[model samples]
Structure formats: C-alpha cells, structure tokens
Target: MRGMKSRLLTRREMDDLITKPDLPSLIADLENTPYREYIIGAKGRLDGILCIEAALRDNFTNTFRKVQDFVRQEEAERYIVIFLHRWDVQNIKTILRGKNIHVTSEEIASCLVPAGEMDEATLNELLKQPDVRAVVDLLATWKIPYARPLTRAYPEFLKTKDLAVLECALDRYYYDDALASVNSPGYNNQIIQDILRLEVDVINIKTVLRMVRDRVDPEEARRYLIGGGRVFDERKLGSMLCLSSIEDVVKTLANTPYRFLADLPESSIRSQKISIIEKELERFLIRKGVGAFRLEPLSVASVIGYFWAKYNEVTNIRVISRCKTADVSPDILKEELVYV
Candidate 1:
C-alpha cells in the first residue's frame, strides 16, 4: 500500500498532464507513468475518453483488490471490507441510474468499478436484467442484502419514477450497515467510524443543497436524510432544511470544521453552483482521509489513507481526460480538479 501511495503523481506531474493539448497527447504522457499497462491495454479496445476512463477504473479496482488480498489480520480485513462495500453501493446506483435513463447496458458497465464484494461477473449479471425492476428482482433472488432496501423502495420508485427514492434507500442501508460493523470499541474501529460519520455528513450536506435548489419542502426532504453524521444531527439537518437558499444552508456550517463551505466566493454561492461546493466538500473528506495516514501508521488509518489517495488520483485523471476531450483550457480545468 505504501509503494502504491508513493507512485501517486506529484502536483507538478498532474499539472503536466492537465496541460496536454489533447487526448492522444495525454495518453502518450500517461504511458510514462504507473498507469501505462492498463491504459495501453484499454487503448486497444476503447478510444478517446472511454479508453482513459476504462484504464483508470480497471487500475483502481485491481489496486484495491491487491490491498484486500494483502491484509491478513482478521479485524483489519473486516474494516477494509466495510470500507469497500461503498463500491457495491456505488455500482448498484450506477446500474439503476443507467437503467432509469434507458442507456445501453454496455454504457453502464463502462462506468462501474467492481472493487467491492460484487465482482465483475455479478455486475454483468445485474446489467443483463431488462430494466430497473428486473435488476431489483434479480438482486432479491440472489439474496443480496442491498436487495432489501431496493425491494422496499420499489413501489415508491414506480409511482414517482424518481431515482432519488431508490438511491437514498441504498445510501441509508450502506451507512447503517457500515456504522454497525464498526460499533465495537477499538482505536481502529473509531478511526473507521469517524470516517464513516464524516461521509454521512458530506452526503447529508449534498442532500440539503439539492433539496434547496429544487425547492423541496422541508418536511418532505426529511425522509431523505441519512443518520450517523458526526456534525449535523437530525435536528441540525432539519434546521438546515428550513433555510431559504444555498448561501443560508452553507452559513449554517460556519463554526464547524466545514466552515470553508461558507468561505467560497459570493458569486459561486449566489449563482448556486452546487458542484463547486460539492467539489470542496469532497476535497475536505479526501484531506481527512489522507491525514489519517500519520495518525496510526500500522492500523486502519493507513488503509483509509491509501484508499482515498488512490481514489483522488483516479478521479483527477478522469477529470483531466474529460476536460481534454472537450478542449477545456488548462486554467479552467485546474478549477474542476480536487487536489488534497
């Protein structure tokens, strides 16, 4: 894990990749990096942004798999498994969203990173289901735990045709299960718990911003809130829900560790560019995860740190690839990236 972390691109190397004129040049530059083998193999079967993205996803999945394989301590492996379950949640969300939009199964498959309990074969099977309902039914037939939440939420999803209904259900289940897994008392479990709570807070913050932007009623939005947040609890989140605008919602975070959300430019706040806020929040979590590296070098903190660092690297590469495809200026592209 330390070796993998050491291979992450430095700020200068990332800048160099960002300044590449086009996709091919970017691919050429990457050939000299750790990503060379995966990118080269992907380039043969895919083209343009898809090639770069596929390589990034494959590399990330393989790296995480190696970490899982390398860890031998039973307790440590359990924590790692809990951390990796998020990927299963994410892959399910991707498939559901793709099915909702009527996209081809291949497109959905391209977006998945099977780094969780659900292997590539399992995901492929889910992709073969005809539609959203079929996918849920298949999961239930297979007795996957996620099937419970999806099955319970399916009725409302059918009535409203709203994907958020199902997505929130998955989020609630995953967070609930993760927190429970780390409920036992230990320094390592505490580390994992803290990270999970921070994640819950991040998700809740994004949920608030979305509700405010869409003008959803406070009471209605309450149902979407996930529990176990370290900072904002039910009452605090409820208060945030009643806030009038994005700026007001952000201001509520002012005295907390997330005070930087309120520090963003007035223009960005006024324009309601939630993506900017979301990116900053994501960077905040990445920083927290990376900081854990030194907290307990031999414990779960190192694992958490390496996971986030790798995730951040892959995400930055993907952003650069997409921006290059669109001919976005280097200056503007830099803003879109989340550097910890």
Candidate 2:
C-alpha cells in the first residue's frame, strides 16, 4: 500500500496535467507518469475524455485489486472488502441512474467501476436488463442482499418515479451492513466505524442542503436521512432541515466539525452552489483518510488512506481531462479538483 501511495501524483504533477493545452496534450503528459500503461492501452480503442476516463478507471480498479491482494490477514481483508462494497453501491446507482434516464447500455457500462464484490459479469448482466424494473427484478431473482431494500422501495419508486427512494435504500443498506460487519471490538474496527460515521454525516449534510434548496418539507426530508452518523443525530439533522435556506442550514453547523461549511464564501452559499460545499466535505473526508495512515500505520487505516489518495489522484485526472475537452480555463479546472 505504501508503494502504491508513493506513486500518487504530487501537487506539482497535478498542476502540470491541469495546464495541458488539450486532451491530446494531457494524454501525452500522462504517458510520462505511472498511468502510462493504462493510457497506452486505453488510447488504442478510445479518444478524448472517454479515453482518459477509461484509463483512469482501469488504473484505479487494478490498483485497488493490488491492494486487496497485498493483504493476507483474513480480518484485515474483511475490513478492506467492506470498504470495497462502496463501489458496488456506486455501480448499482450508476446503472439505476442510467436506466432511469434511458441512456444506452454501453454508455452506462462505461461509467461503471467493477472493483467491488459485484464482478464485471454481474454488472454486465444488470446492464442487459431492458429497464429499471427489469434490473431490480433480476437482482431479486439472484437473491442479492441489496435487492431486498430495492424491492421494498420499488412500490414507492413506482408511485413517485423518484430514483432517490431506491438510492437511499441502497445507501442505508450499505452503511448498516458495513457497520454490522465491523462491529467487533478492535482499534481497526473503530477506525473503520469512525470513517463510516463521518461518511453518513457528509451524506446527510448534502441531503439537507438539497432538500432545503428544493423546498421539500422537513418532515418528508427526514425520511432520507441515514442513521449512525458521527456528529449529527436525528435532532441535529432535523434542526438543520427546518432551516429556510442552504446558508441557514450551513450556519447551523457553526459549532460542529463541519463548521468549515459555515466559513465558505457567503456568495457561494447564497447562490445555492452546493457543489462547492460537497467538494469541501469530500476533501474533509480525504484528510481524515490520509491522516489515518500517520495515526495507525500498521492497521487497516493505511489501506484506507492509500485508497483515498489513489481515488483522489484518479478523480483529479478525470476532472482535468474533462476540462481540457471542454476548453475550460485551467484556473476554473483547478477549482474543481480536490487537491488532498
């Protein structure tokens, strides 16, 4: 994991990629880094942002697999596998969203990263389903655990045609399962729980902002809040949900670890540009993941830390590549990146 972490792009390297004049230039520059092989392989059959994104995704998946292979201890591997299941949640969400929007199966397939317990074959099977209902039915037919929540939420999803209902179900299930799996008394288990709790808080924070922005009733919004967050409980989240605006909700966070949200530019909050707030929250989590390495170098924290660092590197590259394709200014592109 340390070796893999060492290969992560430095700030200067990321800056160099950010300044590339075009997609081709960015690809050329990437060939000089550890991503060279992936870039070369992807360039053979893809182009532009797709090419870069494919390379990045492939590299990330392989890197994570390498990390999994490195861990020989069963207990340690269990925690790592739990962490990897987030990708399953992510892949399922992507497929569901694609099916929701009626995108091409190939297009949806491109967006998936099969790095979790759900292998590529299973994801491909889900992709083959004719529609969202078919996908859910297939999961239930296969007896996959995630199918249970989706099955329960399917009727509500049918009534409202709202994908969030299913998405929230998946999120709730993932967190609950993860917490249960790591419930044993150990420092590593505690570390994993701390990270998961913060994640729940982050998700809830985003949920609150979205609900307030959309003028959803606070009572209705409460249904979407996942339990087991580290900081905000039901009372605290409910209080934030009752606020009239995103800025007001952020102000309610003034005393918490997320006080940084309150410190963001008033203009950003006033304008309801929640993406900036989301990015900051992500960076906050990345900082926690990275810090775990120094705090528990021999434990699963190091693996988690390396995973975050690698994930950040790939995300930054993808952002740069997409910006280059759009001819966006480097300054604006830098703003979009999570530098940690």
Per-candidate count of clashing residue pairs (backbone under 3 Å): 0, 0
lDDT of each: 0.91, 0.89
Error of 1 at 141 (Å): 0.4
- Local error of candidate 1 at 208, Å? 1.1
Q: What would the per-residue lDDT of candidate 1 be over residues 1-340, giving only the tens digit for each residue?
A: 6777899999899999998999999999999999999999999999888989889988988888888888866567877798679899999999999999899998999899998989999999999988999999999999999999999999998898899999999999999999998899999899999999999999999999999988899999998999999999999999999989999988888989999887799999989999989989999999998888888678888888888888889999999998887889999999888776
Write one digit per residue (lDDT tens) for candidate 2, span 1-340. Answer: 6777888899999999988899888999999999999999999999888888888888888887877887867556876788789999999999999999999999998899988988899999999998889999999999988999999999999999989999999999999999998888999899889999999999999999999999999999998999999999999999888889988888888889999888789999999999989989999988887777786678888888887788788888878887777889989988888877
The TM-score of predicted model 1 comes to: 0.97
In model 1, residue pairs whose N, Cα or C atoms come closer than 3 Å (at least 3 residues apart or on different chains), thus clashing, are none
Error of 1 at 92 (Å): 0.7
Q: List the residue pairs that clash in candidate 2.
A: none
Which window of 10 residues has the lowest lDDT sum in candidate 1? 71-80
